[model samples]
Target: MFPFKMSEGNPNDGPTPQPANPTSPCPCRDDTKGTQRYETKEQEADSAQESCYSLFTVTQKRWIVFLVAAAGMFSPMSSFIYYPAINSIASGLNTSVELINLTITSYMAVSGVVPTVVGNAADGLGRRPIYILTMLIYLVANIGLALQNSFPALLVLRMVQSAGSSGTISLGYGVISDITTPAERGSYVGLLLLGPNVAPPLGPIVGGVVSSKLGKLLDSDYASVARTHGLEVNRVFGDDLRNFPIEKARLRSVFYIIMGASLSILAYGWLLCFHVHFSAPLVMQFIIGATSTAIFTILGALLTDINSSASSTAAASANVIRCALAATGLAVVETMVQKIGPGWCFTIFSGITAAMGPLLLLERERGLGWRNKIYQGNGGSG
Candidate 1:
């Protein structure tokens, strides 16, 4: 069995204990998941000193998930909140709408890159400290955004805001993995995704509504002991962090879902770019949002599974793909649309996503072997 640091009870008893009554709650048992497999008896014995499940109770874990989801909202909220106000900011700065969009590109660019550092730190230094630090950074950036007068200030501060807000995602996944079991992970995934998926559609709507009225605004592990403490570990992902075929672990399950999202993006782009019926684009938005959310949810859960010990780092690396690709795309989208028009633009973007289907399928087939090879190389038995 893949060993998570589960409390096996009294060693003298010879078996993991069970709850006395079928109807009674089991200590440290919850509906979600996390785990690690150790190769040595000494290592396993060391792990046994920790909690059987998570350090936190079911109620505590649920609350942590909810809080993390709430925190996750800030990133999307800040980005979309500024959308409707773009024209106003542009006009006030005596700049073009295009330039205003650059601030967004900058925010996304920083959002993509900052997590590498934050994820590493969270895994090593512990989640609570990192959480408090990032939130403060984010809060200050938000305040600056609310008060900034120049485009430069806005651009710089948005990146600052992104730096603060983006790490929450990686952190949440780590926390989820800490408290959850793989078998029960999906249920918590929905809750974990509540902010990310729910925020986008609502973000712009919220942004549009709020910006129209006011303005813009928003790992794992060290699994064993960290799980027992209801926090992240005070260590890094180790020499093998970059060596694993993480791309395969992350994208394999989502290959078809990506294609679906690509199609959805294409359709949404067509509706928005062309003079389509109002509700048509709205419907496409829903479709695209749902599809994209599927990609995030699936990939997030899978990465957590693969990097059970260093889930935060895994989630952070995943963000690099999601945010970096988005930043790259956003950087060029307007220029592409200007040169080719919406239909062709959507076609190109959709094609970009669709092209991945083959690689991802290959990932699905060979990913396990690749991961095992990494483990074998590291003197670990998969």
Candidate 2:
């Protein structure tokens, strides 16, 4: 409608030049509006650049995607990986666990802000440089963390570490968006999330091993220590879950998940405080890890059900809120433990978690069925 050519006018038509190749640059002027009609060669080439997925075969692409997702996980991994060393870190720094725990609050605070800036920069500067920059920041922070003996140094460096690490998962999502179509996006996202989901449990185990045997050996003999240590529900419901009542099927599961996770949290802190057994906390960590993963997965599905198109925004919003709450929780938890003692402090968190159950139940009662029906009627459109 904007621009059209007349059929090669009959033979009587004035002679016309051959049309230009679309790929080749051919600037044209519209004298009436004084506008240019073509782009430069470089711009055309940029427009023609291949997608991120085009460079690899199917198998290769999967591996690349998985690796990127795994790399993204390092940020979350760093958070928990240091957990087993919390007491050790406190003792080594000659600081209270309360003070050491504030590092977690600082970390989450910085994490909440870093990704917004990093994402905007990624849009402006490209992903590779930012990725490299963040990784260097994290690496340097870890080095400092290992060497520093003071609480303030620990606090400042953890923030720096989060600054470097938090945007990685967002970057992973960007990659999935670049390579995948909507039909396949859900699976890719699930796989990408696996990195974070699995890291919680494994982090503590690895952290424990490294800080204990490995750290001592490195400091002493330099050779004395060399050691290392190391989801099915969706299938049952499958696509059929979409046909069923979304709220009842999905959210009801969350009820159980929150219950289990809350209890695990309470138990973990109780066991540690009482010196029940070292393995007890580890076991609780594993349960919490698994339950938390399930909770997130289900919540994701619920959000998607509500509005698929806004799922990314929903996730980002949730992350920000979660980080903020985590910061608050972390800030208070240490002091709470000091004042009320660990047993009751954990009980309080357990109660907080239990509080969520009733809220979820309320949602289920209010309009869960109606909302699910609306979603279904809409053809699950985003």
Candidate 3:
């Protein structure tokens, strides 16, 4: 600077500053040594900050868990919603209540059994395809049930429906396990269980209202409209009514309505398979079934997450804790259903299920602290 600024020297010339020795600590360091150490400390601080930010971003993950949980709920909703409609079904099909009961039993049995088989398939084939296939089968079976007049046809279709619908539960849990970390698994799993737990009770309530109203409208006993339409009266009630000749116009109208609904559902199912948009009894059933399916899948996924995070010795213990929580939830739902009826059961369950979203935020905070402790321990060991 002196040479450049001085008038006697060349204007472009300047003294060069000496290079600092790489081994020498800067004067800025009070210790006057180990500058590399301070640099490393700064780097570590930056890394830690980045890690903290990454772990804190769990809101998206929680939403994924919720969706998967919702999908899992659909299976139970589809199966149980029709429970209240059984008598109407029996009447319409010219079948005994016992046969309808058998259908219900078969539906339940298949739902329970098929999931185990499909669970393996889900693991092999992956969640998306399995979910699409399951929903499609369900849609087809429902449509078939709506169209078919024969009891045997109904039974077979019902079986197929259960088989396709049941896979959702297990696969849903599998998806959850994929996304969530171990420390945060429990809360999501609990939320997943909440869907189906609520479905049984809510289904019957809606089913009862719809079935009763539909039965009334379809019945020959109604006064003004019955006479207006010139509908025939059968002396026998319920099954006996099926044997009576339904007016051609009335039968055609009913068939049209059923087929129309079935077609709409079929169209929607195709959309779902292709990941396209669709529209409420049809979409509602899918939603409920999907939610239930997702819940079970999330449960399994959360289990896997938990297993991965814990030590081998602690894995069994972790599983026990999870199972206990699940058992407790099941017991609570069972008790509630028994004490207050299925309608309230679902209401309470849904409330609890929805509540899990917030719980995930809390768990994430606690999980971060726990993970820090584990990290610290590992570092100390190293």
lDDT of 1 by residue, 99-134 (tens): 998888888888888888898898889889999999
List clashing residue pairs in candidate 2.
none
Compute the lDDT of residue 228 as modeled in candidate 3: 53
| TM-score, one value per model | 0.69, 0.54, 0.43
lDDT values for all models: 0.70, 0.63, 0.54
Candidate 3 lDDT: 0.54
Minimum summed lDDT over a 10-residue window in model 1 is located at: 212-221
Order candidates by lDDT, high to low: 1, 2, 3
Residue 353 lDDT in model 3? 55
The TM-score-based order of candidates, best leading, equals 1, 2, 3
Provide C-alpha RMSD values for all models, in order.
15.5, 14.0, 23.5
TM-score attained by model 2: 0.54
